[model samples]
Every structure is written in C-alpha cells, then in structure tokens.
Target: MSLQGEPAHVLIVCTGNVCRSPFIERVLAALLPTDAGVVVSSAGTGALVGRPMEPLAAAQTERYAGSPAGFAARQLVPGIVDSADLVLTATRRHRGEVASLHPRALSYAFTLGDFADLVSGVTPEDVAAFGESGAEGARPRIRALVRAVAARRGLNPPLEASQVDIVDPFRGDETRFEAMAQQVMGVLPTVARALVP
Candidate 1:
C-alpha cells in the first residue's frame, strides 16, 4: 500500500555517495519490508558520479545482508529532495544541505543517527494511532510516523554530538568501514519498525 499515489520514498545523502550513503541505502532497502514498496535511494553532495561503492563499504554492506551491485553515484539535485518522503543524511551538514535545496523538506529531513535516536522512543502503535482517523496502510502509517518522529526533534536532544552523524569512511581501512556499518546498522531496525510495522 502507498500514500501520495506512489511508494514511499527515502533518500540518503553523503559527501561522495560511494561509501556511506550507498551502503546505508542498500542496507536500509534490505531492512525495509518488501511488500511495503518503499523506495530507497542515495545521492552525493559532491558525488563521484558513476563510481561504485567503496570496496570496504560494499563488503560491509554484503556482510550485513545488503547488496551493492550496479550502484553509481549521482549528484544531489532539487528534484531528489522534492520526491523524498523522508531524507536521512550522513551528517548534520548534509541535513542543512538538503534544507537549502528544498526549504519545505526541513520538516522531514534529519541526520541518520539523529533520526534513529529520535525514533527509538516512538513505538509502532504511536505511528498507527497517528493515522487511525483516516490514513491507512503502511505508506500512510509511515508518513505519519516520519511526521511523528519529526515532531519529537526539539523534545529530545541527541545523547552526544557523535550520535548525530555517521562518520565518513570513504578513505579509511576495513576497520573504519566496520565501525561505520555498526553505527548505521545500530539505528536501522528502529527506523524499519516504524516504516514497516
């Protein structure tokens, strides 16, 4: 089921798109419910256009049950922001960039780590209850869920400065990629539950 007459769209952003964003995109895609028809994609602020995921990051994605096949980086554009129902960026800086690209998107755009943390306290029932009056199905429920999470932004601050950004591991070793993957995977289940529950 879909809201807005189409599948719910989630966009992930990073600097180069070859490491952080692509890996997160694939993992998040795999995590989302297949029947929900959620569309997950990624782009870069300064993309290495046409490049594939960084080898180490791709390996981590595979380790975590995500496929990194045939991926190519694309530069972030305004339309991408406009189409996204939810935008999860690698860092706070990327969140700001998305806001600058589309001011209206600010309400639904968040740093990936920040989103995970904020949504941690939001249970599946809260999301379903939000759209209970009229909106039904996973798509509307997800839309309501994103809005619900966004509403909690000012109420709960991140525990630490580091809890708000996924560190770029593009130029790092396998260890760095592993750490990055851990950070991302740590929060995805919370997001998936809200979106697909």
Candidate 2:
C-alpha cells in the first residue's frame, strides 16, 4: 500500500534477510514521517524467500515497528534494486552485487553504515531548505540529501570493514543479534531524522 503517486523507495539488502535487513526495514518504516511518502523494504542476496524475521530480531522491531506484522523475507533481484530511489545494502559486497545488476545504481546505492557515516554531519540547516509542505516537499528534500551524501562518496579514504558494514547475525545467539541491532539502531536516529526532518 503505497501513499504517493511516485513514492521514494528504499531497498535494504543483506545475506539471509532474517536479521539485519528486516530490522532496518521496520525501523525506517516506523521512523520516517508518515507524510513523507517513503516506502522502505528489505531483501537478501541469499534470502529465505517468504520467511519471517528471526525471533530475536522480530522482538526488537516491536520497539520501533509499531506492530509485528510487517517483516517478511524475500530474495533480492535486479528488478527490485532497479526500482529503488535509494538502495542501502548491508555490506560492501552486497553493494557490489547491486552495482553489478545496474551500473547507474551506484549513484543511488550505498552500504548502510557508510551511508550513515557519510551523512552524519548534516544539520538542521541542511534540511530546513525543504520547507513545510509535508509530503509534497519531502521527496525532493530527501533526494537532495542523498545527492549531498553521494557527492562525498570518494572523498574519504576507503572504510575498513567495521566502519562500512554491520556483521551478519543470522544464526547467531541473542547476544550477537543484540550487538548488531545496536549498531544498526545507532546509525538510524541521525539518518532517520535527515530523511524526514
């Protein structure tokens, strides 16, 4: 159920689609402004394909997702990435997979952690220019912010693995999943504000 005639689509990708990607998806869905007309979803490079998120991950999503009914795992494909306005991949390698599917996606796709790091410095002034038209104005503003981040992609030296990625915690115990969710959530607050600010 899309709101806008042409909504901004955010596609998050990971390996198993059970933990990180689904968690991020629900967070974004809950965090983004309702009027902003942004649609967030997740898929996996090697997804479970029609499965639910991990129990621990699903438990965490309730704190942010408003309900437990929204998370579902699916396989990733070029067509899904192709339709996205922004593609936030779980790993650099996943980003590579997205790029391999669509060369132009490079401009729109980013590793989630790297994307968070790249845009961490954005201020209220950066978002203020979008004005107050609600959803009508949020789309261009989001695109502007994305471009602002994309422009800085190569300026920084390459990120070591830790800074650029969140470790996969698919089959791990509750402790590992908690740590991964914390990292993902840490990046969420600032970036989520930028998306709907």
Best TM-score goes to which candidate? 1
Query: For residue 78, what is the lDDT in candidate 2?
Result: 85
Q: How close is candidate 2 to the true structure, as a TM-score?
A: 0.86
Question: lDDT value for candidate 2?
Answer: 0.79
Whole-structure CA lDDT of model 1: 0.85
Best by lDDT: 1
- Over 1-197, each residue of candidate 2 has an lDDT whose tens digit, in order, gives 23454567889999889888998888878887777778888899899988888888888778666344856788988899888878898899999988987888999899888888888765556545533445344455666677777766777676787876887887888888888878888888776766764
Clashing pairs in 2: none
CA lDDT scores, all candidates in order: 0.85, 0.79
